[model samples]
Target: MNTKAFLEPMGSWAWWRSWFLIFFGCAVMGTGFVLFINPYNFVPGGVYGLGIVFHNIFPSVQVGTFGYMFDVPLMIIAMLIFGGQFGTRTVLAALFTPGYMNILTRLVYPDAAAVESLDPALLLGGRLDLSNDLLLTCVIGAVVIGVGQGIVVRQQATTGGTDIVAMLLQKFAGIKFSTGILLADGSVVLSGLVVIGFGIGTAEAEPAGWMLTLYSLITIYITSRVIAYMLDGASYDKLLFIITDKHQELRQFILEDLERSATYLKGKGMYTEAMKDVIFLVVSRREVRLVEQKIRSIDPRAFVVVTDAYDTYGEGFKPLPDADTIQAE
Candidate 1:
């Protein structure tokens, strides 16, 4: 009755659906980088952020090209270090991102032979000198990036770049992925500060200031939140703890009717000093009402406690390891 078992037969509908989501997400993310983030010099971290820094220095090089340059090497390193962890989907995502970014730029500015030729300030009409609005620009661009990244994550694929680096670090150095991302991106942001020359001196082209640094941090925060919302929003699962004497009936309903599993724990009611059987399980938000109704039907006086299970990784939930990486023990 493991729900995960039924998914992902070769070339199945789910397979196509997963790839579609990953590609679509990559396009959205690439658009955000090329059109909004790169133009504004909001270095929010990752390959795209580094690409922005490089693009400012070498205006001739498209930001997507820079991303491609970095992503390929990093992906190779990931493959070498973590066998089976970096799969074809990751490769496709890494490759698709930069190419689509260039494509988006071309679509936005058709007359230009390449995205690099178009003026960076063209989208803003070069009005920023008169009214500096990096904050608003950062917020809008970060939201777009977050939406794209969230969609990619929902498909269980990464856009590569520092995401691969983070995984590698976690695998080899025992660093947590979250911590590794913070450190890697934090260093990138700091580098951006120096590259943009915040408060030191404004260059003739691509002026940088402390505001951009602050905005970059803010953008990262917003992007993380958006990803979380997309991955675990209203549909997040719930963990239930039910203390009931009707353990057999409850277990039967959970196993047969709900097609779900449960764990039983023997406990003593602290106040009543009576032996109690505690049934613990997690179910989707939509299943809560049905479960509650069943509980009430079986044991009206059952002590039920429900809590949010923000992330659950197991047989019927998210896989514990990266789809393409070697699963760590």
Candidate 2:
């Protein structure tokens, strides 16, 4: 296994950046849980989702404390099973996130009585109380949580809840990672349906049993999509396939005018039986017009195909993950 990612020189910019992302990401995730997810008892998955389910039964114990109860043991088991591949950053993120959640809960609900009682009405003076608009709340909460988790993942670390469980399932039970995650989170969501939705652990039964389940599914879907968007970036990059005769001129225009690069491929027209140069270029969405105009000016009959470049990585684009980072991941 490549160790360079985890063994980055201490005090380097990469090291500092990784640390910052971990802390900031964990804080944002905790904030999303404390303010949006936990108050509404939305079990969106992971240890926190289970914590929310259990919180209904034991309101006195904060969700973050439950996170610790679940994560610490999982971390130890993961280390034993996977060995050093776990990485220090992941362990730190897992440990720090729960504390952040617990602290944020305390800060958000200053009144001890309100906190212990798990009073949703007392949260943030009801500023975030969108109990009336559950859908909107779920979307916003999912986005916040997804962005935070995305940042942590980008730094080659994880918040380490159900992720470890998924890994374990994959290793031992021959379950696919994604499938394992779905099963784990799905169970947690189901638990919410039973515990909170059915009023099994509450003073009264919630009327929104199936509705809560649906909303939780929506939350999970949106959160996953947002996290994917965060990691892969916006699909606003345009890839151009230009079939033109003026290769030199177009190449000059791309290099000097556009400050971009392109690859040249030799091709032949099936009908014409003539050799040609295919210019493969990738540019931002805004640059497509300029490129098209330049191609037209150079070769009016240029056959240009433009498509979306969802994610690009290289010297000019996003930097590729280093070996150490990749291995750590």
Candidate 3:
């Protein structure tokens, strides 16, 4: 019998438990952005941040709310790939975050809130209305947003955002959740830098441009790291499995040109029933192309497989070596 088919439906009690997590996560997502992003007009991370930057660059062109604009499309895409719990969870997060942010916007009534103790350095910076204490905003905002995000992920829920796209790509696009995340998030950050510079007034436009650039970069970095950590797909590596007749030649090339090591696994082709040598090498993702080129040069018919090894261990992988150690090898 199929294990899931044998399982019973989740009860209302279980349903509410998930909703509770989503609600809290959404609340944090909303409140933190309002305090940090909107007040300072700092762009959001990923697509949301990109929207802000886009508006800044092209004042006449108005996209919808950043969260909602990204959420609807992203959730739809995620649902198509993941289905069921994963899809539903992302939809709820995507929808709820924006709504909650709107509600929180009204509640906070920026004018109504008693003057909270802001950092002294920010007031001294004199960049804008809140005072240009970018350091405080960046660090505090990351912590505040990251905490809520961590909680939701721990509960296996989402805080909305482009995380839905990341999840979808992970399931169907044959991509890691973290890599997709950086792409989605970084995509927004990059767009924002370009868009935020559209206005005419130097005083108004200059600050927006600077803040948008800074916010997009930092937020994308923070969110990407946080999401990858939560989802267990965070790293910077490419795992290469090369099956070649030229074993010693390929091995030496990596050790010398790439400054890497390989483990020779004696494998066999199931179909051919012929013995083969498979060389396993772990290198930075950027170096994959070069490695592949060398493999082709040495053995054109070699079977090469490249994959995102989210995390790796052992010699010549990441905790890395000095130039001397690499050279000595």
Name the weakest run of 10 consecutive residues (lDDT summed) in model 3.
320-329
The best candidate by lDDT is: 2
Cα lDDT, model 2, residue 262: 85
lDDT of 2 by residue, 252-290 (tens): 998999898889888999999999888889998888999
In terms of lDDT, the poorest run of 10 residues in model 2 is 320-329
| Residues 69-174 of candidate 3: C-alpha lDDT, one tens digit per residue | 7667766766565556656766667777766665555445432221122222242233333445665675566656665675576556565566665655655666
Q: Write the per-residue lDDT of candidate 1 for residues 1-329, one digit (tens) a residue.
A: 12342355866887778889989999888877766677667789999898877776776788888889998878776556554433566678889999998777766654554355455555444433212577777787888988988788676567888777766776678875545566678878877787774532325433545677888988887776676677556466999999887888998999999898988888997888988778889998899999999999999999899999877888777777554332211
Q: Return the lDDT, model 3, position 89.
A: 69
The C-alpha RMSD in Å for every predicted model, in order, reads 6.1, 3.7, 13.0
Candidate 2: residue 66 lDDT (0-100): 91
Model 1 whole-model lDDT (C-alpha atoms) = 0.74
Clashing residue pair totals per candidate (backbone < 3 A): 4, 2, 4
C-alpha lDDT of residue 286 in model 2 = 83
Worst 10 residues of 1 by lDDT: 122-131
TM-score of 3: 0.55
How far does residue 291 in candidate 1 sit from its true spot (Å)?
4.1
Better of 2 and 3 by TM-score: 2
